[model samples]
Target: MHEMLGNQYFLIRNYFEAEKEFEVGLLSDPDNFKIKKKLIVCYIQTGHVDSALTLFHNIVSTDPKIITDTNPEEDNCPCPEIIYELESILNNSEVELKTLSLAMLWLYCDLEESIWYFEQYYQFNKSTHIIKSILASLNKEINK
Candidate 1:
């Protein structure tokens, strides 16, 4: 089934394929926690942090330990390399970089760093409320 195929691709670090497979599997088994976990990593790895975080919030609502469940060694979820690749460019003062970096850091569960980037982003683009909303929601989760 798609879940098995997704797991195989996940283990191989082919996150794009894994994401596709997991998404399909999820369409059939929407409550599959394992698939959701792997898909979250795949989403963040593939620069789909919005999707990842959406699913993350969904799961974390019921399974409060999902963050701890996503360890690379224990769960085979790799650290999203895009975050590293993006780090090298953070010195640039581009709004998109700040937004992308914010999303990446947030997905990595680096809330402190994500907040830092969010601050940087807010300075450049204060008009958008979506990013603020995301940070607020994350703050609520952490505060609770």
Candidate 2:
């Protein structure tokens, strides 16, 4: 099964291979939360922040508490590196990346910051149902 092979790749830090396998695995079992979670990890490990956020929004829309790999000790976590990278380019006219970086920053740096970013994003894109759902989930998470 793709998930089995993907697990091996994930364990070895072959995130690209793991990502491919997980993507395939999802095609057959779209609701397999485990695969989607791992795929989110793979997306981040591969520097596909947009992809990771898209998938993350999908999962978090239903359960906001599932923000994955916020721990610095987690294997190959690039969140800190990403945050660091953002400092140099945070104001480089890449609106999406800046907002996405904020989303990521809260995972590894400050949870409240993510809420602020999500709130700002919502103000500009109120029609985005996914952002609304994510914002609600973030509120739910903070309230708990």
- The lDDT leader among the candidates is 2
Give the whole-model CA lDDT for all candidates, comma-separated: 0.68, 0.73
TM-score of each: 0.66, 0.69
List all candidate RMSDs to the true structure: 3.6, 3.4
TM-score, model 1 to reference:
0.66
Clash pairs, model 1 backbone: none
Report the number of the highest-TM-score candidate: 2
Tens digit of per-residue lDDT, candidate 1, span 57-104: 676556534554345546554654556656667567654744644453
Candidate 1: where are CA atoms >4 Å away?
47-50, 53-65, 91-109, 122-129
- What range of 10 consecutive residues in model 2 has the weakest lDDT sum? 68-77
